[model samples]
Target: MLQVLVSRKIAVAESICSFELCSLNGEPLPPFTAGAHIDVQTPAGATRQYSLCNHPEERHRYMIGVLKDPQSRGGSQAMHEQVEQGQTLTISEPRNLFPLAADGKRHLLFAGGIGITPMLAMAYELSQRGVDFELHYSFRTQASAAFLDVLAEAPLARHVRLHDNAAATQLDAATVLAAPTPGTHLYVCGPSGFMNYLLSTAASQGWPAEQTHREFFAAAPIEHDGDQPFEVELASSGQTFHIPADRSVFEVLDEAGIEIETSCEQGICGACITRVLQGTPDHRDQFMTDKEHAVNDRFTPCCSRAKTPRLVLDL
Candidate 1:
């Protein structure tokens, strides 16, 4: 963890706020990519990841924007009420999995609500590189949308279209995502419902899985039907253990005195990722891409499982 100070705080939008953070000694922090996020240690010791929303070229500081989540499990509320400017904060180094890959000549960007934060940085990076891209920004209304002022002045503003759900007709998915084009990449970040709808619609139109990328802030719970038991073999330690359906892999491992690092048991945070040396893993997490899971052979043990009667993990 890195020690930092909240240099300043400003209202960037109606429900969105921006915090300019820097090291207490004003030293340069570690360099980070455009879509990276830092895990901030809250006053309650609850760590929450917030995307770095500012230009990475700026060497002096990091900027993080937070939207007040009404259904927040206390983290957002504590940040708004207790976190003060100039206060010292502990933050983890930046980490990025939602990186922009060069798959095509043209890019279509889609963002919903606070999901616009990371896409805002991507838009800036693409503009700097002179990449052809367009942004489709959707929000409940103008007041609730963040970064409108800054985005309006950007050179890429000509390619951006903002939709206000309150006044204008809802964004038509068909109008925006009509025909699939070759050499065009689509990026989406939003609520689960919006993401599911967009991805399903795009897939129905014959968009290949590789042509699209996404980032999600919330993940639904994993559901299991019956109490089926399974066995897990730790490759490194050469130990095998039974994992009952009622208990998660992490819980069983901890009970057996096997140590592994973990943070978000819910799977939104990619902390507990481990390699699946050999097994058909019944993946239940949201941190990894379907392709990544298939090829990389990594799994989040906190909430995933093995479909095979016995599985081997490189823990």
Candidate 2:
């Protein structure tokens, strides 16, 4: 656990708060690229992941924005109500499941609500490098938009577009993702419903899967009412564990004294993904692409389960 001090905290929007964390010893923090996130150990004892919104060039501090989600399970609420400037917290090094493609000639970014956090960093990087990119950020209203003033003063300000639902200036995903251009890449981060709409629209518009990328802030609730008991075998140790319908494979492994690195156990993060030596996976994770799931060569043990009664894992 890397200890860091919260140097600053500000209300960026109506319900969003921005935090700047610096190394406890005043040393440079771990380097991170755009679209990277760190797992923060909250005061309430719940771990939460927040995207790094500061430019990658700034190594002294890591910045993140958090929305006070009403449905939060204590993380955001703790940060909002209990955490303050000068507070020290434990955090994980940066991990990126959503990375910008380096080869794209033209980049199109879409951000919805608090999803703009990662995009803001990407915009700064692209602008500094003089890359061709455009950002379309949508919010419920101007009052709810975070960093509007900051964006307005950015070097890429001319390419930034803001849409407000209350003002009837909503983004048309269909029109924006209508056609695919060679060497053009698209990235989106937003609510599940908003992301699904963009992905489906891009697919219907002939956008290649490789050129389209996305990140989810939270995993959609999955119903496991029909889950069944299954068995997992570790190929290296020849040890087997039985995972009950009510428990996850990760929990079963932990009970057996086997541990794995994991964040966002809901399958949004790929940290707990393991190679599958045998058996077909149910593939419930949103981290991997359809092609990766079709191969059935890898699976997230945190949330995914075996389609077969017994699964052989690389372990």
Candidate 3:
């Protein structure tokens, strides 16, 4: 973890905000991809992850935008209130789990609220490559969005659609997620409820799970029936941990002094990712797709579990 500081803070909107930050040591940082995110250790030491919106070619400083969530548990509130110029902070190196597939012929990007950050970078990448793509940005109002100028500067201004309405303008999941032509990929980032409905609707419309992609800002509730306890074996140490019926995998690992790189313990961030060497993973995290598991036997330990009694994991 590297210590950084709040170099500058500027209010982008009534509730949306942006910050220009740099390493406290004033050294150049590591490079990251388009959809990369950094785990921010807030002034209060509360760890949170936010996507990097800056261009990949620029590496001197990192830029991040935060939306003032009214329901925030003092994290975003503190960012809006106490995080000022020259305040010290600790941040993790960038980590990117949602990257654009090179083979995608047609790209459909969706953004809701602050979810536009990563999508903007994706649009930039696709534009640089002269790829065919479209972006659908949905928000409560135009004032609530950030970086409107950059979106308009893209190659396909006609392909950009903005819908702002708190009551009207329902996310037409069916229409927006219509059958993808061959080599088409759909990527979405938003709140849990919006993503759940959109994904289910897309699935109903015959969009394969592989063609649909999503990035989660928060973890959705786990859909489970009766309680079940299981054993998780750390492949390296050969030590088994008993996951209690009520406790989550994160709580158990932390209590055992296992240093798992994680930001959102709720499973929104893909930081606590590990390989599922054996057993069936009851994947509860939103960061990965079912198709990804078919090729790579990886899983997020923050929310995923084994369907069998004993599961082996690569720690």
Candidate 4:
């Protein structure tokens, strides 16, 4: 973890707080691509992932916006009420699980509520590349919209379309996604319900899975009542281990002195994604895209188990 100073803290919108972090040593920080996020060590002794909202080209500081969740998951509340400007904080280097398509010809970015954080960085990068892109930001009200000041003067403002539900600015997914142009990719980040409805609309329109991308802040709950024990093989030692129904593959491996770097063990982060040398995975992760999971080449060991009795891992 890197120690950084919280140089600035301000209210970006109703129930939303923005924090600016700077390297403690007064030097350029590690470089990160757009759509990257860092694991923050909150004041309440809990770790949470927040997307880097500032331009990736700016190495001086990293910016993150946090919404005061009524759910009180500990991270958001701590960031808003406990952390203060000038306080020092610890954070992991940025990791990207929702990066832009390298060769995408055109981009359609959608963000809802606090989901706008990563979209800010992505818009900056896309604008710099001179790529054709549009950013649709949806919010309940202008008073509750975050980063309005930034958008008002930001270079990417021209490419932005604000959709305020209070103003009756309806966003018709079917109309927007009607013409499926080849090479035009779509990226969306938002509340699960918002994403589900939009993606469902896109799917109904016959959009290819490869042409869509998304990032989830949390995973939907899954049932484990019918879970069964499974065996996992480590290719390096040809050693096998048993994974119980109650324990995850990660827990089983760790008990045997196997270490797998992980964050968000709930399977929202890709840190624990393990390559599958053999056997199919009972994927329980929300990190990988559906197309990625269908390939069955990698799975998050933290929450994913094997469909087969015996599965092989690259280790």
Please give the RMSD to the true structure for each candidate, in Å: 2.2, 0.9, 2.8, 1.5
How many residue pairs clash in all the candidates, one count each?
Answer: 0, 0, 0, 0
Local distance difference test, candidate 4: 0.92
* Candidate 1 wrongly placed segments (more than 4 Å): 225-227, 254-263, 269-271, 290-296
**Evaluation by TM-score, superior candidate among 3 and 4:** 4
Model 2 stretches with alpha carbons more than 4 Å out: none
> Which lDDT tens digits does candidate 2 get at residues 174-286?
98888799999999998898789888999999999899999998898888989999999999999999989989999999888898889999898898999999899998899
In order of lDDT, best first, we have 2, 4, 1, 3
Highest TM-score against the true fold, candidate: 2
Residue 282 error, candidate 2, Å: 0.6
What is candidate 1's lDDT per residue for 7-114, written digit by digit as tens?
A: 998887786788889988877888887677888888866788888888767668988888878887877667777888989889988887677776668888888988
As for model 3, its CA RMSD to the true structure in angstroms is 2.8
Candidate 3 residues lying further than 4 Å off, grouped into runs, are: 24-27, 154-159, 166-171, 223-225, 290-298
Cα lDDT for residue 308, candidate 2? 97
Ten contiguous residues minimizing lDDT sum, candidate 2: 154-163
